[model samples]
Target: MSEFIDGVITEVPQQYSPAGELDHRVHADDHSNDWWRHAVVYEIYPRSFADSNGDGAGDLRGVRSRLAYLAHLGVDAIWFNPFFTSPLLDGGYDVIDYRDIDPVFGDMAEVEALIADCHSYGLKVIIDVVPNHSSWEHRWFKEALTTEPGSPAWARYHCVLGKGVNHELPPNNWRSVFGGNAWSPVKNADGTDSGYWYLHIFDSSQPDLNWDHPDVHKEFEDTLRFWFDRGVDGFRIDVSHGLVKAAGYPDYPQHADRAKRSAGGEIIDFEPLPHWDQDGVHEIYRAWRRVANEYEPMRAFVGEVWVDTAQRRAKYLQHDELHLAFNFGHVGAKWDALDLRERINEALLHDKAVGAPTTWVLENHDVPRVVTRFAGVELPKSSGDGDENESADDALRRLAVLTPEQRVVGTRRARAANIYMLSLPGSAYLYNGQELGLFEVVDLPPQFRQDPVWFRTEGKVVGRDGCRVPMPWRNEAPAYGFGPDGSTQSWLPQPSAWGALSVQEQQGRADSMLELIRTAVHARKSHEAFGETDFIWRDDIAEAIAPGRSDVLVSEHGGAGNRALVVLVIGTDPVDRPDSELLVASQPLTDAQIPGETCAWFSLS
Candidate 1:
């Protein structure tokens, strides 16, 4: 039998000769040059990026209009969130059709145009592909539900039979990333027990397909080929870990008593689930790698592995698996210099052993904005004393607390973080609006909340809607011109103070956060060390910071060179020293006596 291994063509010889004859040689050169290893990826949320049509939402045309802006940013690639035909469930993660573009986004032609335009501007386009599950409205899922259990279409999915049987029984103890039961009861149109249930790792609306099925594998392979045929550069796989599951779904062990509350009056159960890091996942990834190899230029597949441990995270990046797995440890770490250093060191060491690159991200549409998470200071409510309605004075008072110098310090800390992430030897992902120092919207009205977690978690999680607010494009236009019409309200409301943070205002102001981002990106592009470089952290400096104190992180980068590029990050809080060698500060570090917030690049020589 012939099998494709990691996109390489290999043939099994019927019999081995006494002299150890070779059957076939795999094409080692095909998968060797992966551009994502040293590229900077900029993530764009299609619905909020720009509006080409007068539909109040962003479309492909809108993205086309912004090609120059992205090219100007100096990122090598753009990872567009799914613009495929979807029911808008889970923010387009519930893909309805893998082949067609959503009507709201544009037609298939428009997508191709966007890709062509991006390529013309020297930018690579990577689309988000949700293979773990599909929208219940997907044609295949609909056919599976309607067709007989033994039919081909039925076999294409994980449809099982009998109430509480394979269908009714819980797949295992695995819990959905979103809170609640992972299984959804399947019923026939006649309202009787179908004698089986379906597994949805996330929402009931998203039915997880069984990858163990041979036909299912073939179907996805064809889908991958379809996109490759369409000239897509790569795929940012959603929930990359959920492609495979344990043989039998088992119950996850409860870490703490749900009936009891902790000192913070919060239910605390943060233990690891038994089946999260399953062994079967590797096989599925290897299979995807085989499919990716069939195409030229070797398409990239970056996975989102949400594990806290470095070893488990590194496992996803094993040579035959994904090109890069999200290094989420950095994203989840506290905003302390020392903590960041430890996480980066762990990632660098683990990836070096596996001979795989890492992907770094500070913010994403699915999480709270990094600025809000690390700003160190919280804003006061619109109402000064917690009242619903308040005068403009309350807003002014809140703004007053965040002085220009404080804002500069905060922005600088963020810039330092960016320098640390981009300078590392891996692909770096910059979330949309991150360049503009976008913060999470403080309060979202009930009607404005779109995240399912808000409903299941009872508002305790704050949901992801705050971070999904529309991008601010212009300062004077209504709603900052994020919507199709300048006067139209965006799908996701613009943050209250977004008018002041518009792209136009930032572009005009040299000192704006947008300019700072542009400078950093250009710096990364101009430096040869940033591309295909190796990181080497100073052991003495790393060891100096206290284990628990999250201040002052330091790292050095060198690859076959006598001199090294060093980066020093200072946290928002005050530093111990009055003066030091300021290599570069994201924003001006007043505490460090840094002249400006701009990143200062220097040669160790």
Candidate 2:
């Protein structure tokens, strides 16, 4: 067993080896040019990941200290959420300076060291790039606030005159993704309200930049080079579809679906918003792609594009655009066999059309933990009528506290989901704490909540604080060993139950979620079946034995020497295991049957 000193692993246990007794890395030394193609990129919400200095917030040094743990976990890359200079209004998405590191995260030298350390461990680093908007405190926005309406400084953002006769109303009938109006009135230097209202599709503190401006293009291009020159592998472009708006600042349809964006960053009701998924946005990505190609072993770009359909989403993945775009279909799909199959096929088929690899994401910083979402736990309805009248605190109070039985079901399904996702042909993204089987911190005190969504909606929306809770590292240490010794608090409170789910608790256990993920990731990296292969739906599994059984899903990928079979049983009934050599199973199996809510892989060569 690995020994832990204040949640930091003091000794590297044998089981923690990236590869076991046998070296299974098929392409061990091949850090090929296109590493992101099938790479397992682990997403880290820096503030919640680790606290090296016991300052209560996670920082770059914290992440650097945990690099070994990640390497042991067997991910090819680490994708960080924004650590840029920000006001923290939108969880670091409201970037104040694209070129500098936020003090809350660390200094530039630390980031440079982190990048160097990651490369030393054969781990590539992907940082976030928030181009859609700038923080209200950003120098550009402050300048815009001080300048005249049509001045060059103001031209950087969408600051336009309001439509009311007295210039008192917002420019158009648009709603913020967080809540209320999308346009916030600019203030004069002496604090008088300026007639012009600036657009912020999400939070009022995040003013949208005018992408039409040539300076805006030049600025972002320069920022891309700023990081690319620093050995950064790639960037996860935030709100990739919202940079460009329709011409003339067209008014949003009055009766169109105005559903609030989900915690997962998906449009709950995905219609073409006047300011989202516009055709002009592709031009920006195409330009960005050229900048990325400027570096040797060309850097990659993965867009957080949330469009209505798979076809539209694929547009962002064209040849010279983004290398990959997040496929939210997996996160949004119901926990049913047919639903998952459809989502998987849709992503594969559409991404294949564009000759781009499909990216699979189960959970991220913005979404509810899959363990909570898949547990079949439902929050009670509010007494108030709909969201408009709902009290955010009351709704948070009413969030479903998972029952013990629900935890079991959710964990089993989540494990199976990871195995299933990893078996696919393209790249997969793992959120931190997911391997620990951490559930959403639904009961976070209303007073401690900091997400702008909750405050913007006046507590009518609980926001994503639940999923951003600090990671539990030790079962017995203070703050669950999330911070340095003697540290008593984390940025967000962690549940006591997490003591049983911490890394120290599951370090060497054979059946632990952490180990399962490690084993799966190692298998994915070593096995040739996951590399280059023809993906086929294995109807033969059902046709040969469980004929007419729709609950069982089977697929195969890889060529002659590296073929592998995947079997997922989503229904209650057990299915006959594949005749090939058993490689790995999400859960312990009984006899020769794969039980419900279980996924298994087998070597077919």
Candidate 3:
């Protein structure tokens, strides 16, 4: 591993031997100061990971119980969705308490224990911080309601007097990401007009915080110190590019607003959006980076900054700002060789210029699962006005729904895609259940859906709840083994067909999705070429579409450019394999050739 004087090189701690856990990764003798540069982090939505007390919700203790499983899976860190105290609106994004864990998830003690357990398993812990907004129930917001307009508590949030007779109209025509108007009128406890409104870019229950307030800045610093002292390895900042809105919160030109913006022909790069990715946001991060650097091991921060272009995304990764900002280009690109190649190259080139590691991600909790997105349908846009104001809705709705045949194709492509993602330079994030080859559950009975987008949009949009379902543990009668032995209640419903996809069903089978992931992570962690932050496009191995050989996607990097090419190939063709030792393959090749729908790593040693 590359070393830097400023970086922390950690020795592998004596590990924990939990029930049914496998210790498979090779422990490195040395590591770089930037351990996160090439790390593979797994995202966990706590409420869906496991339910320890049969409370029908996944809790911190449940995560502790499964720590060994994650460790065995060979991930470097676990990035959890917010488990802070909340009112359950926006699925915990509407955080009421930043200092303590939500009672439903467990308390502060459980969080401390979970972190210790993860470290014991040689895994780091990164928790989510929803800094852009706060639950309306937060003490600050509640007090803001009681105080007069322009009061200190009111100034902490985006609270302002409405415009019109008796102050009835919203401050501006800004739109709510959840749906409808972004401003919600505040009423006094006696149910009378308070002559003011609060800006809630998301659900009305989540009022946006005023980063302009000096107190807000100090408050987050305090929050960061509290958790860092508690030993969290790092934090994944929610809406990292969104804490500061443009001055005045002006209206976005409605005429220019389009329902879908995607990685199609023209990117969503040059639009004059006023609410997100503002310059002031960087100042906040520059200060945050300073706070993160204070501790040993140099605490890390990954941004969920969904800007329109790679260059814009890179701006957040400037040395003193954020360590990593997600590049969504590859994740949102169509499942085409050219589209994928260009996105990856563009991200690598931009990040290289910025002297930052490029982050490659296939899917996350906020968007449609890649399997469904890459089914060659209209790329399902995550609900909101972010990507060109929404997501890509260019494809006809008829093709959006995956048919039985489409699912098979999608699944195979997804398998190959994951290997391709693991092969890329720099860091990567794997959402929970991604290894299980999970797709968005579109057919959830309308009644079972809980995403606020469904209600806020009056069912016009389904939002991302489908991707957040509690994962299947085993093939049991109720909840597919999500809860306790005899329980039927999980926060979300599990599909009956998921029985075959359960961890118990796929555990050790060579062709199983679980095995493919385990082997891929194991191989990725061990390979020298895969760990470095470099990618040299294989100019000779052109991507084609002629049937069998056309499906191949190859990119090689690491070591001398010409001396020994580290080739990563994914396709279905029976061919003369790369002239190298096969380090690992997502699935066994056919007839000694790189098979279709499989990805293989080769070292030309």
Candidate 4:
């Protein structure tokens, strides 16, 4: 059993003030003792995990059954995607109720059981909470639509009436993520129009709640308490920065006059209207923090801050906001050593600036799998050279010819990327199936496509469903062990060629991608570099390891006082030249190596 610390290292300072610095050290005594700083969170999409019953959908029981597997995987916490009562619009982002679990997944009792089971395995549970908006079918919205404009329910949402004289439209000009308008017209039950429209910011079925209302604030506070009381460890808040919008609802600079032409033309901007930022949103967060503090000391609250700049991202973590905010700059970055080093340096510096913990993720439900995104390798195409080239009938044979040596080299590069993410001084989130080296399955048929992004963009955007397919458990099992026992189909079909990457098959192979993940995770837990926050980049050495040199070297200076840990990752991919070891090898990785390959580890003595 792991020893429990009263408080884990939670905060990393931007600047060192030897004597008068803020007590950024996270100890058991601090109110916000965020344990997530050192956690390795594994994300699970309920629909794709294992299904307990034969209902063709995954459920809480399915998750409960997999506790042993997760616990054995060495993850500190599990971040479950939304399983709350929802219309399934936007994949459960449109919540109809905040307190109950969706019957399709299971009931509240089953969720409670899952929580209990996870705790039994020493695994903390962090569930997704969509605080920005709720389904149009939510009771509050139903009441707002039926009640008079002056009623309490009416004030709970952002509703504005159009003025004929002024030509007033939706409060502002912010665009919805899924495209189109951020406001939907509301009609009263009496057959007369309410004249006022509600703000959505996403799908029209999801109406954004007004934080300016005391009742709305109370509802969320209560909702959080409801889950906290049920023993939930924490929350991964969805669109956390979007809670409170500007009060007056002002117009933004027009990117274009029409929807098709504007940069963010589809939706309306509602945040800069009035005093949105200062309008009690922080107060609500502080209140939630107070309640969270009353429970387990290390309880965490992570927010999704989708801002572009590090400065703006730091604002969300300033004080009493979120314990950790998701950093996306790295995920969106192109695969370049210099670019990665700069991004990492920037993120670490930002964490110190905010005095709040930071979280890193390479892949998530909304993004493509990291293997497909970060692996700098391309499969050789069929050249029709009758002698060496093979046909579609020889696809599996072609796959066989693609040597394990090649797979190892490619996987090591990916593993090095994982090392870079985990070695940084913050919490790291591992999306489901990422550890298995899963690639994005773009072969999804049009009929089975569920992502709204695909429909809104007319397929211009590939959408995120390809990454949300069922997890493969066994090599030969139907639906890759995601469906009912012996069933061939699943809620979403498993990727056709995923059998070779199944967990069962990889578990037996010492050199499989799954083994690499296990090794990296295990090493992360065992290394102080993964847990400690003092990292000073060795600029001279870092620049020397940049591309065209065949290796990437990164050194971090810090340890008690004078000691330092230097990590060297050697690339063996085709892009990297052979015999290109510029610096004397400090520690050579025993794993496979190919041209342009990469391996990671630190030397600390």
Candidate 5:
């Protein structure tokens, strides 16, 4: 499988290996050394990003309209959430059709335009691909329901018989990541009980597919070709660890957590289970890799893999498998400096062993915003595990727990943290509203809330709606310019305070969050030390910050031998730093010292 890109023959070497990877004949060097290896990809939740039409929801046309903004922000790539035909359940993860664009969004032609526009700006376009499961409304799922259990349609997904004498119970006791039974009773098209259960790891509307079927492999291979032909630069695979379940669909380990979660459920790390991170999943990637290799600049796959250890996380990025896997260890860490350093060290060591650069993520669409996360009292990992499943209303009824003082601290810390994050080697991802220093909108009206996690738990859990609120593009309008004009109302309500955080407001201010980000990102893209693999720790700074607050940390990049590309973070409190050429600072330096909540890049003398 190969194609020519700019006179260069780009194709995965056809070779054989038992591990489902390219053979020794095909070296990693043979693969397209794509721009993604050094890219700082910006993740856009399409519905919340800039809206072009007055329809109040973002579409491909809106994304195209905003290419100049992303280009100016200096990101090498833009990764969009799924825009495929979907029921909008699970935030569009329940894809109804892989090939068609949703009506709410534009058509395939609009997508082609968006890609062309992005390429014009020298930005690569990567769209979401939800491969682990498809919507119950999907054509295959509908046919699988009525075509009999052993039919071709049924074989495409994990459609199977239920248990008990009358087949009344679910197929197994497996739990859904969204809570309740993982197996949902199948209803015939004629509106009668089918007495069989189908597997859905998340929402019941999203039924898991049977990857063991050869047809499933061929179908996705064709899909890869479909998008590759369409000029899509890459795909962010929804659940890369998922695809092939362990044989027999066994129950989780006896000691696994019963409290269900969408993140691949409770990971029983010590033992392998029915699904999630199975070795067979790699074989699928190898085949997909061949398909991607056939393209011009070589399409990439970024996996949303949620594994426990860094060692296990590294396995997915093997030579022939996925190019990058999100390190959740850093994503879930608290605001404490010690924990962050430890996570960074572990991530670096693990990814380095597998010859992959470690990725850093400060905030994403799924979780609480970094400013909000930092504003609150830094909780231990177990601090707020399950808050008695507080309903959306109940949670909103509570006062704004994040105090004004806390917000100021949180915002500063977030901006400074990002500067430090970008300075690190490897790639980084910036979620939609982080540039505006937008905290989570934790108080959306009950009627406006839509995350499936809320309904799945019977409103007992307020899902990730807060962070997914419509972005504030301009300072004016009740909807904060998320939509086209002042008259259009955004799908999700924009907070009144957003007028202060809007991009329109931040444009001219030198000290605005947007400006800080623009400067840092520019430095990241153009710095010679950046994107280099050289990293060293400077522990001597601990003497200045003192033992009571050993929070200050400095990391030297690029200058491995004589000179150094220095990055010192004075997080806990302000501290004097050695005088040097200050390249960029998240905050104004005081007395030739790195101030608290500031990360400064330096050009060593």
Candidate 6:
């Protein structure tokens, strides 16, 4: 018999075992279909990016208006988060209609125009695809809500019979990633409790689909083709680790040390829980890849996979599977040179084994802004051990309760991190406000909060609203020029101090983060070295600059005659400058020393 302990099932009478082996074999393909390998992709959360209609919300047209700015920023691609038809719960992740655009975001016509505009400006468009779940208002979910058990509509989702005799309890002890029970009890028309329950790994409003059902697979494939037919360059898959759950809704294991590791501190990878990081998820991606390959130029797919280790994360990037998967190790690592170096090496090594390029990201719509995160606020010490789970929402939760932002310190560290990250091999993702040196707006009033996480947790967790605050484009304009003049207040309030951080204020300033990022991005494009997926640590140079010092990290890229070196000084003391043509520096090099907490790039002849 099973018993509930602290809202989790401790044991189950009948347990479902998962498959022991993973099918890691991938399709044989050449390097011709690889556009994202070294691409600089920018993630634009549509709602907070720019407001177009004076409706206090950003729309597709708003993104269309910003094409010139993005083109000038030198990003190869723009990854727009879902503007699909939705009720706006979970920030559009709970997609209601796969084919239609939400009225608030604009219509199908605008999306096509925006895609065309992006292409004209030499930008590839990658839209967010939320395949794990759909909004409750979705036709399938709504029908499942009223259908009888074992019905076809019910089969579309993971609707199962309850455990108890009276069918009062959830089928299993699985808990929602957001909070509360993963199972929501079904109800009759009169609102009486029905004997069936459905699984929702996320919010109750978002129901997890039954991948075992062929209908679910067919629908998503059709959805993919729908956008691909409309000229989307690729897809940024949301919750790519999800979608396939364990066959049986088994009870979640309860243990303080849930992660099993080897003596060397590497995660002894095993299939995670009944809900997450399952092996079956790979088969689905392989099929999706076949579909993507059908197109000319081949639409790419990048998964937002949060697994236990870099090795496990690499599984999603097998040749026949996703083209790229986001690497969170770099984001979750502490702001230490040694820690960052180890993580970078691990990711590069693992990704290289799969013949895939590492997809690096600093911050996103769901995490704390890098500026505030690296600021003086305390971060949990990382033991230089690999924990790939830190890239997910749970890790963000820990950051939600951080100390207030220290603007000067955070901005400096952020600028340095960008220079260092951009110099690394493989692709890099820049969040929308990252270039403006935006820090987390941690002090927004509680009443103004809109993140579903903030409400679901009943104010216990502060949530990601801090990073999702509307962008500040102009210092003096109302709502910082997020919307047109005389527009309604922004959906979320912006900090008053962002006036100095606005693009208008930083545009021409050589010392501004925006200019620095622009310079670094252009350098990455102009140089042939950054195009390759090979970089060697220049330990000899580091020793030459700061003899026997472990604080200075230098990497060399490109060929001998036209090589480039990226130097990062992480210690308190400055290092002697290298004898190379200066390309760009996070901070002004006032003298012959590279200041501590500064990163610089130099051209070597």
Whole-model lDDT per candidate: 0.67, 0.82, 0.75, 0.66, 0.75, 0.82
lDDT of 3 by residue, 169-236 (tens): 99888898777889988887788878889898899898899999998999999999899988998899
lDDT of 4 at 442: 62
Residue 118 alpha-carbon offset, candidate 4, angstroms: 1.0
* lDDT of each residue in 86-163, candidate 1, tens digit only: 888678888898888999899999988888999999999888888888899988889877765556776555665433
Which predicted model would earn the best lDDT? 2
Q: Model 4: per-residue lDDT, tens digit, 153-270?
A: 8787888875455424554565666666677666767776666777777778888888777877788778888888888889998887778776477655544332222375543223
RMSD of 4: 8.9
lDDT of 3 at 41: 93
Which of candidates 1 and 2 is the stronger one according to TM-score?
A: 2
Task: Report how far residue 57 has shifted in candidate 6, in Å.
Answer: 0.2
Q: Give per-candidate clash totals.
A: 16, 2, 6, 19, 1, 0
User: What's the TM-score of every candidate structure?
Assistant: 0.81, 0.91, 0.87, 0.80, 0.88, 0.90
Q: What is the lDDT of residue 199 in candidate 3?
A: 90
State the weakest 10-residue window (summed lDDT) of model 1.
4-13
Question: What is the per-residue lDDT of model 2 for residues 482-560, given as tens digits with 9 covering 90 to 100?
Answer: 8988898798988889899999888878889988888888887787777433567767665564678888888766665
Global CA lDDT computed for model 2 = 0.82
For lDDT, candidate 1 versus 3, the one ahead is 3
Question: Pairs clashing in candidate 2?
Answer: 392-459, 392-460
User: Which TM-score value belongs to model 4?
Assistant: 0.80
Regions of model 3 farther than 4 Å from truth = 1-31, 188-190, 257-272, 377-401, 543-551, 560-576
Q: Which runs of model 2 end up more than 4 angstroms from their true locations?
A: 1-32, 254-271, 379-398
Q: State the lDDT of candidate 5 residue by residue for 377-490, as single tens digits.
A: 433333243345443323432223476898898898888878888877778889998888998787788898888777777656667888888888787867787777654678
